[model samples]
Target: MANFIKPYNDDPFVGHLATPITSSAVTRAILQNLPAYRFGLTPLLRGLEIGLAHGYFFIGPFAKLGPLRDSDVGLLAGFMSTIGFIVILTIGLTIYGAATFGQEKSSGNPNDLQTKKAWDEFKGGFFVGACGSAGFAFICLSSIPTFTV
Candidate 1:
């Protein structure tokens, strides 16, 4: 019949072949949509902040004592340890933040659960980072014992 004959363009086989979407493509799409600052630099910045504070705290004591031993190596190690802890903390916090706060679609919708979750994550991250950094510093100090103060 004349009605049964479809146009060539309407034929399924004649259409353009689309690229199949894979799991990797979907993951890339999600990552691309996320805010770079929140997902990437926030953690690193937080770690750097902690490291700077630790360095400042040591400055006074280091200045008071005259260097006789391997202060340079010890200091470098201590700083590196602090930086490492910060990296760990930042990663933990970023993952937590992404899971907890990232689901909210609108700033206008104020939900108490979101607030509580954020608070809990913040406290947890602080403790984890602090404990890790302290433990690392203790190990480094015990091993090196460079500062007289």
Candidate 2:
């Protein structure tokens, strides 16, 4: 029927073909709708993405090192690295957030709402980023054959 064909007929590629071989509409529809960030999901998701990427790149060379060559030692390194990363990021973000958002109306007053909010956001992002990186790094490192093997 004309109605059935109209949808395909409207498409440039499909119109020229006897049958619609591929459906661009389906792809277009999916591309249009994506998940929106609500609450603090953005930082968490970003951290995971960044951490995975970091892990992917980090595992290779580090795994080959002397102490890290052992799976147990490597895992410990990963944990240590994660902890260190988290601490560094926390301190740096806290300082940055405080300086940027914690402008005290009165010179001597130190506590404020904005600074707390900024720190919370940074905390969410970096915590995931560091943990994710370490987890992925360890997983990848474990798979490799060590010198003992």
Candidate 3:
């Protein structure tokens, strides 16, 4: 029978407070899997690459325009970080769904349960990258001096 439920190992800490850690683990598992890795790479790399690109393009232009307020910086960083995460989750989930469909189609057994597991892991991977990015952005943005001039 297909296990429709997403497994999170029944750990309270993992279930409540540490989604990023779970996400990273899922991402790692997906990456380690030879077949799924190829499909997963697009979004994984995209999050990092686009985040860097956005920072480079927007920061300099904004700086050149004038001195930015801390709020402005926070808003910009948060927006970009959020967008990057959105991209990661959207793309990752799409790929995961497609892969799951493919797996189901290829198998003769209609009761295959691994498909659900794969989906859960992919969700975790996406969450992991998104959380990591958000945390990093928060820390970096928070450190900026809120100089009230």
Identify the candidate with maximal lDDT: 2
Compare candidates 1 and 2 on TM-score and give the better one: 2
Write one digit per residue (lDDT tens) for candidate 3, span 88-128: 65577667676756545333322232454444444555555
* Clash count, one per candidate: 0, 0, 1
Tens digits of lDDT, candidate 2, 1-149: 44334445466564453233244667556644432222334444544554555545554454455366656676567456556656676678677767776754333212222445534554566566666676766766567675753
* Least well predicted 10-residue stretch by lDDT in candidate 1: 107-116
Assess candidate 2 and give its TM-score to the true structure.
Answer: 0.45
Question: For every candidate structure, what is the RMSD over all alpha carbons to the true structure, in angstroms?
Answer: 15.1, 11.1, 15.4
Q: TM-scores for all candidates?
A: 0.30, 0.45, 0.34
* Residue runs of model 3 more than 4 Å from their true location after superposition: 1-88, 91-116, 146-149
Candidate 2 has which clashing residue pairs, if any? none
**Model 1 lDDT per residue over 20-57, tens place:** 33224786687665433234333334344344445334
- Tell me which of candidates 2 and 3 scores higher on lDDT: 2
